[model samples]
Each structure stands twice: as C-alpha cells, then as structure tokens.
Target: MKPIVAIGDVHGLEKWRSIVDEHEDCTIVFLGDYLDPYEYITRRQQLDNLRDIIELKKRRMDDVVLLLGNHDLHYFCDRALPGSRYDFQIERFAEAMFNANIELFQYAYQQGNRIFTHAGIQHSWFVDDFKGDLTQPIAHQLNNPESIQFNAMLRLGHARGGRIGKIGGIFWADISELTDPLHGYTQIVGHNRVDDITERCGYNDNKIIFCDCLRNGKYYYEE
Candidate 1:
C-alpha cells in the first residue's frame, strides 16, 4: 500500500503548504473543514488558508484527497453548520472554493483497508438504509453523489448527530457510539476534538482514528 499521511481539520492554516511540500510523494488525505474561520480570525486569513489548500490540491491532484466536512456542507444548506453558534456563516466566495476542486472533494477515500472521512461511518446507514452495492468501492458511490437517493443518504449520515436512532454516522457521530469497526475498513475521521492527532476510538482491530488536530496553525498528519 502507498504510505498514507492523513491530515485533520485545517481551517485555513498556511502551514498546510509546508506539510504538503514535505510529503511530496506520500498520499495525503486531508480531512475537510477548509472554510469558516475561527471566531477571532480575519476573513482574509480564512480566504488565504482555503486558497492555499485548494492550490495544493490542484498541484498534487493525484496525491491529495479532500473530503467534505459538515462546515463545507453549508453550501448545501441555507443555514450555518450545526452547533457553530452562528459564529461561522456562508459567503459568496465559498462557491468559488467549491467550484475550484469539486472533483477532489469526495466524501471518502480509502488507502488499503483504512478509510478516511470528515467523520466516521454508521454501518447501518450503508448496508441497511441506503442499500448501496457492496461490490463497489464506497468512494465511488460518494463521488457519484448526484442521485436524489444518495443525497438523502448523505444528509442523514454525514451531518453530526444521532440520526440513526442510537449514535454515530460520519459527521454527527459521537465516535463513542461507533460500537463496531464499521465493516471491512478501519475508519479515520475528523470533526471531533482531541489533544493529539493520533488519538483513536474503539479497540484492537476495530478502531476509529481522530486527526483534526490543527489547534495550533501547524500542519499535522498520521503516518
């Protein structure tokens, strides 16, 4: 398998440029959240950060994968992301950012048996709810997300919350309720808080790794 360098939440940090530059050959799967600056940051910094990230993906198209985050979903919704407390709002520039790299921003990417996403998956959402074809790669289904049925599945499963009766479903999942290792793949996720980039949930062979560790404007990755 190609050595994977999975990065976590980066809300417009310039250090991403250096991180990508350093890992010129490794496959870098970036967990999304490339927009909606922090409360204290200026909008210019947010634009610069996203622009840098977009440019990096453009330059490293095959090596980098940009998975969509709940914040990025603001474009799909008329309102702000959940629990953002209105501190973050959508803007016109978001359209440009989304348009620039629509092909690169998938919902999931797989490296060997480990999969990456803005959040983890709820197995039920795939097998039971959507009835997605198991013969196909999940990434293929996510990338071809123009179907109305698939869009419903995306909204139900990709946003934060216990929409699945109990808990866990990519963006909204509490991580604690993931319960199982999500059939066939050990999921790597963002959208949750952790002190370190390598912090993981679950146990043994079944684990969910959290990598949204951009607390400091520095780049981080899991080898």
Candidate 2:
C-alpha cells in the first residue's frame, strides 16, 4: 500500500510546501484551514499560499486529498459561521478561488477502516445528527450530504460555541465533543489544535487521532 501522510491545519504557513515536497511519493491528505493566518502572515501571503496548494492539487490529483475545514468553509459557503479570525478582507478572492476549483476538495476521505476529516466525529453526531450509514464509506456520505445532511455538517457543538445541546459536524467538531469515536473505525482529523499528534481510543477499540499540530511543526504519517 502507498504510504499516507496527513498534514494538519495550515493557518497560512509555508511549511506545507516542504512537507509535500518531501513526501512526493506518498498519498498526502491536507486537513484544510488553508487561510486565516496569524497576524504575522500577510493576507497576500495567505492567499498566495492557498493558490499554491490548489495548484499542487491540480498537478498531483492522484496523490492529493484536500479535506475542507471550518475555516475553509466560511469562505466557500453562502452562510457565515460564527468564528473568529475570518479574513473578510480577502473573502471575495478566496471564495472565487474555492468555487472555481471546488471539485478538488471534499469533506472527507477514507481508506479501509481509516477515515480522514477536518474534524473528529462524535458518536451521537454520526448516529443521530449525521444519520450516516455504517455500510457505506464515510467519505461518500459526507462529500455528498443531502440538503438536511449538509446543514447537519455545519453544526457546531457547545465546545465550539454552538447551542448548548448541539454536536458539531465533521467540519467543526472540537476534540472535546468527541467522547467516543465512531464505532468500528479509526477517525483521523485535524480541526482541534493540539500540542502533538494525539490519539484517543473508544469502544470496540475504535480511535480518533488528532493531527492539527501543524502550528507546532508536526504531522502524521503511516504505511
């Protein structure tokens, strides 16, 4: 099997360039958040970085998988989500770029029992909210959520500042919201920031691996 290398939230960093170049032979999954950089990174730099990523995907379609994160969604979607650090200054440009190449992005990716998403999936959110099918690959359901399912995917749980009882969707789930990983699957996600690549095991030996450590100069890799 080809090796898999998962990159975490970009936040306008250029480190991804080096990582991708180093893993040219591997299947690279970008965990999104390509925009909304820290104050240090200029908006132009952020925009250019995003363009570079899109171009890379265009050049290496077979080897790259881009999963949209909450940050990326605010720019792509019509409705605005409640969150800080949204780059309104460049929204028009970013939105256009995303729409133009939307086909290159998806909500999730899967391989065997491993599923990759921007954020972790909670049990209740999957069973009650998402209403996903266990028999089908998660990516298929998520990438093609129906109107209602699509709205569900935009939910933000309490941890992320949503209503008291709501559970966040795949794109917005916080690490704290995931009390249990989805049954019979290992979820790889990158929305919540962490000090390092972290792993939590749940029922049936299912697991959720948090990889949003790009800010700390870390990434996850496996064969």
Stretches > 4 Å off in candidate 2 = 80-82
Question: How many collisions between residues are there in candidate 1?
Answer: 3
lDDT by residue for model 2 (26-121), tens? 999999889887648998899999999999999999889998988898997975494579877899999999999999999899999999999978
Q: Write the per-residue lDDT of candidate 1 for residues 1-223, one digit (tens) a residue.
A: 4567777777665556666668887888888877665656677887777777777778878887888887776654443345462233446677666866677678788766677877776566656655566677876665565565344434533235435464444555555545664676678888776767654444446567777776654334546
Best by TM-score: 2
lDDT of model 1 at position 180 = 66
Off by over 4 Å in 1: 76-90, 146-153, 156-168, 198-205, 216-223
lDDT for model 2: 0.89
* Pairs with steric clashes in candidate 2: none
Error of 1 at 120 (Å): 0.8
RMSD of 1: 3.4
